[model samples]
Target: MTDKAKKKREPIFSPEDRSNLRWLWLGYLKKRAPWLGAVLLMILIQGLVYQQFLSMTESGLRVIFESGEVGQLVLVCLGVFFLFAVRGLMSYLVPLVTVRLSNEAIFEMRRDLIGHLMSLDLAYFERTKSGEIIHRLVTQTQQLGVFFGLATAGAVRDAVTVVIVSGYLIWKNPILFTTAIVVLPFIIWVMNFVSDRVKQAQGQAERALADYMNGIEETVNGMRTVKIASQEQVEAGRLMKGTGAIRDLMKRVQTTQALVMPSIDLSSAFVYVLVIGGGGYMVLSPDFDVDGAGIITFLLGMVMVFDPARLLAQYFGALQSNLVLLDRVRSLYDEQPSINDAPDAVEDFDTGGDIVLDDVTFSYSEDQPLFEGLDMTFRGGQVSAIVGATGSGKTTILSLLSRLYDVKGGQITIGGQPIETLKVGSLRGAFSVVAQDIVIFNNSIWENIRYVNPEATEEDVWRAAEDAEIADLIRRRGDAPVGPKGAQLSGGQKQRIAIARAFLRDAPILLLDEATSALDQATEERIKAALGRLTKGKTTIVVAHRLSSVADADRIFVLEAGQLVEQGRHDELLETAGLYSQLYQAQKKGYDGR
Candidate 1:
């Protein structure tokens, strides 16, 4: 194929293909032990019924030769009828039970996958796209249903049937039965070959699909902005490119999977033709005197065995893909959380909200440092400010206190103990943070406020909302929907709801990253007053490029190029006439029209 043609083809195998389908099968079966027993009972009943049919055939022949009464023949026919009826009823019941069981298992598995994703540390989310994580949690797990139900477990039942039928065929005609059995291993080898390719292609396709889905999510989420900015065509072009790649990958995967079935069918047909032609010639000529009727029954048994074996064979490819899916799942399952509770981590920690960072250095990447040699502290029950230009590590300092990332060097202690040694939950429980870009869910205003503390009563929620000055806004909603991210509300209103949530959390430590940056001057003044009162008994750390916002802080630290260059009370820093002084003077000059 040409490069263009090859590119158009979908991938066949995925990393999940290498996953152990046997485990997926065994685990699911173990979960559905009751249903499996029912299916087994049905199988046993059917086998006995089939055996009775054979017996009836022989008995009827003898009766005809002996000229038995017509009543006896009628009785024999009724027995056969009853057996078939019972078998059909059991067959129906088995599937109904197994299907229900499998569906419930899938639901449980999906729920666990979602919980697993949520348990992952924030760093994993930072490195992974929202869509990719969602795809694994939703789409990939959805694909496992067929594998869990009809493919894996169903494969087991059909395998048992094939063995029983093969045994019958061998007893009736050893020569033909041996030949069919001998051909199975070769057919399985070929199926396994195709299965390997399917797994590899599917993995690539899954990744491509994740990329496409991510693009789609971004576009949908930003559709309004894209339209207003006249970037629709640009976005559409990018989506088209992504969609095209996904299409190509899927095509290759489907083509490889499709070929396996037909190839196996052709192999089976060739074997059948050879068996019939060779068997006839041998029986007609010399030593072999195989009875024609017995041969017919044996052939019928072979047909029954072949269908299930063929089904099992075709499943090799699906099993491969399912394996890959599970591996991806297990990868997530096996991950160690970046942040976890320490053995002796603090509980109900009462530190007067003092935070101390001593010679801390940190980096997201090995070679690129976000901050270096940062020493800072916020006094208990005091408002401290960090001011810096963009990328000056202001936010990085807040993150350090939150313990979002551990320092690469030096120690950060809370209440005279290394932060790492303290229980992570206990340490984090002490801080309430509101970032520059606030997020609100599509929920009732009351629910959003209470999100910080689910156990918080309605009275507590209302009190927080009132303090944050959003009580009236929420009351006006009167149980109406608040659109996603609070799009239905004004920017200032949305910020207040976020504040309400943080207020309700009632942590001893507060980190506000430009919390009031979006509000008008009048609203900013009101919120500032409220926040000032709120932080009176808490350690408050504020980051603001707006010098006026930080002027009232007990102490202000100026950061530049990942280093703290200046620190002192606001007026004292101004007297020093350094970086902080320069910023204050510039803002003052801008205000005075000098």
Candidate 2:
């Protein structure tokens, strides 16, 4: 396809996208409509009082010039003071209400976003960077709250003020008002043009910020690797480049804003000059019978009109910037999780039975198939081992059995029922997986074990820890901090803590994925003993790298390039001299040479 064709095919905003934004905005307003309505009423009252101040000024001047009674002059002065007081009070209260309402809306949005993120499938996290998600949830959501709460309200209030003041000016002196506003249309056109530029600049700035955040996130996450490789200078240079790009984009947005404010001021200044010059001629010339008070009132009203006009221009620029943030927030809300429960999905499942994969076909992508029409059965209440080299589909089998990813073709059954029909939470709860890549939180050992079962008693925790052969270590630590990612513990200690968690879970099905691949010989032997007891009654599937670990299993399945080529017990497979026998012999030779 040509570049032009591809560009045309790309969608900027579909009908559905527009609908999502409308729905999001309506939802935000619905939650705080009462507070917003009160704010609007206050702003309206303030605008009316502001107009009263202009009239009072005219009346007070007329009273003094005509040498009216002292009482009448005092009354006019008091009325003007009262109007100013009310306007000042309303200005303060409106902002106070707006800020509170905006904070509440932001809190609700954050809570919902977190809940939505939790509902997404595992594959979403696998493909997306954590920093990007964090940026959307934290920075972007905050901007939306501020825009909706403060900027939207301020713009509306400014617009109302401009309309009221302009109406009064036009009512008092139509010819002068019309002459002053002749250049308004051109000023509006310029502002609209600048608004588009601001929006474009804001979009670029947000993208650059995301990139800068990603650079910082990657550096912190891989700090150990960077330090060991002596690449601090390299990482620093990369981050500086990202920061520079963000700074440049932000400067463009600020430059646009600076230009907009001056243009608005210059436009309003021209209108002010015209009104002042014309109103002066009428009051001073002997040809026209214009009173001093009347001419002074018209000039004051014209100044009032320009005040709101300038405010509205500023609000328009701020609104344009916020519109970009709103679009980003709407996009996040529109994302739908790829995996969700079926409409008629079962809510309860019985986990006791064989796990059977019938002619399963699967792959991460279409171009690179990982498994093709494979079949296998893991019998209940038995230890079955899947031994193969790296990338031989061992971990993939375990993932499929757990239904983390559904098969591209065929079906998986547990306890004589199709796994797809089972409830997702209950199906996953059936197994306790202990993998070599253990994840330990920075918490107490006791708390880590109890994470599997929050209601587990202290005695129960101790028993599980003892079974995993880590009770002594826990007792010695006695609730010492585990540090970040269990930095306080050794490799074997971390694995044992994971084992204790699985034992505490007491699930009916178990999966061990290279559970001892990185441990020393003595530690592996100790963990092996605990595993034997743990798998005695449960249906266990072990993915082993070393053939020696699964030599005593009831049966062994050998996989090669996503295909299962051999299955039988230790002696039976050796006699057949197939792939299993070849792998066993190679490992045996290596062990003897060592």
Candidate 3:
């Protein structure tokens, strides 16, 4: 596949790139630009209200020093009341708009992440830790919400305040205004400097957090095993150590980052005092000769302006932390998928289910080999079985047939076309898999079965279930709730349900990895009989653990440590006295021992 095609199938975020989050946030803001304009209008109204307050205060001062009119004083007081009311209302509305915009952005981000994750190749899931994926989906997504809701709004609001307030400051005294605004550059420099340190520490904190979360997930899922082992204290200590690491990382970041606020605060406050003191001297000294009314108005205006400036300093510190989080999220969004289909790839509409491997070599990692110099073929309308010991790359064979991972050295073909040249959707559509580890969702039997064929009617689902010998079980659970992960069902029941799902799919190719291993011998024999009727006229590959399972297959392939050692009919292989014959002898001995 071409690089562009590969990128299209990749997840939106990756661990290495951290800039996508910034782009996503910018995109979200652009989407809500209209609401932002409305917020700006409200801000303008707020500024006008503050100007009115300055005027009212000045008028009252005049009433005290010059007019001495009680009527004028009452009028100014009335204006103050109305101005405060307008300011309050505008403040309330600005936040409402900000929150609405932020929430919409978060919703879009979450949906995009999920959609991208779904499109990624299955190999990514196999390599990446499930706990980490869950952490990003649930915990990191929540943090993203905080970024949108608090940091995004605060940054914009503080920026607006800085602009409006600085304009008012310039109007008061150009000299003081220039000096006051000078501190902003210093603040920016400090923020940028502090952010790098914060980024490093925050990244460490997130890693530590992931470790702690991983422990929690493992512990929760395997609580029974941990308790049975009587290693609860050791586990608790390990968990505590992880949590402690996270706490320490957070403290380091928070401490160093916290310095930013006080530094900016001291600088802003010094500037504020210098401006106020200079203004006060000018107002008092007759040599300066500034008008009392103008001075009073300017001082009141400065008061109105500086409040936001102080808040800006506070929120500037908050922006640093948000930047760190944004960087982390963006890194994930930027990852490239390792495997993807070609743009001009053929989409398989009629799969005869013929599969071939041509001098293929593969490895999950460069340093570790799973397969080397391997070649095999499975013809259509035949049942082929692969038998091997654990870690002998048995399952890897099935994965390659489906193109779950790209072959490192050679090619895999399905229906005479290179699988990489076929669109992923089309390739997957041709095959149905029943893996050793059965996965059942928290849903009714009918719903789970129909998951493989969403358009299938109840009748179709029941028919498939009957073929899988699971129709009677579903009837038993007609009203029974299947708990999460199918916890309510036994292992055998879950396996049957998975088989039913595959049967309902009715794909031209079927791959089974110990599909009946969870069932008792009697149930396995029963299901095998049913499968005989179901798998007719289709290509089938079964990874067998028991010799009995593959005795009836058209062909049996023996693998030991990724090498294909034998391939033939069961009886023919036994007569050859190769790896297959040794396996058969061992199984026969075990059966006779029983």
Per-prediction TM-score: 0.88, 0.90, 0.89
Question: Candidate 3: misplaced stretches above 4 Å?
Answer: 1-22, 174-193, 264-280, 290-303, 479-481
Q: Quote the positional error of residue 274 for candidate 1 in Å.
A: 4.4
Ranking by TM-score: 2, 3, 1
Query: Ten-residue segment with the worst summed lDDT in candidate 3?
Result: 8-17
Give model 3's TM-score versus the native structure.
0.89
What's the lDDT for all of these models?
0.77, 0.83, 0.77
- Give the per-residue lDDT digits (tens) of candidate 2, residues 232-263: 99999999999899889889888887786688
lDDT of 1 by residue, 1-594 (tens): 888657533334433432444555565557677767877777777766665665565455556557677887887788889989987887677677767777887788778777777677778888888888878877877777756665665676667777676666667667776766656677766776677677777778788888888999999889879989999999999999998888887788778778766766776776677667656765676787764444545555666666777788767667766767777665677765776677666665555846889989898899889777789888888899999889999988877776787789999887666888877777788889877878778988888778889999888888888889889888889777688777788878778887888889998888899888778888888787778767878888999988999888999999998988999988899899999888888888897994
In candidate 3, how many clashes are counted? 10
Residue-level lDDT for 527 in candidate 1: 81
The model with the greatest TM-score is 2
- Model 3, position 24, has a per-residue lDDT of 64
Residues 190-300 of candidate 3 have per-residue lDDT tens digits of: 776666566667778877787788889888767779899998998999999998898899888888877776876777677768767776777788877555775667766
Cα-based lDDT at residue 446, candidate 2: 87
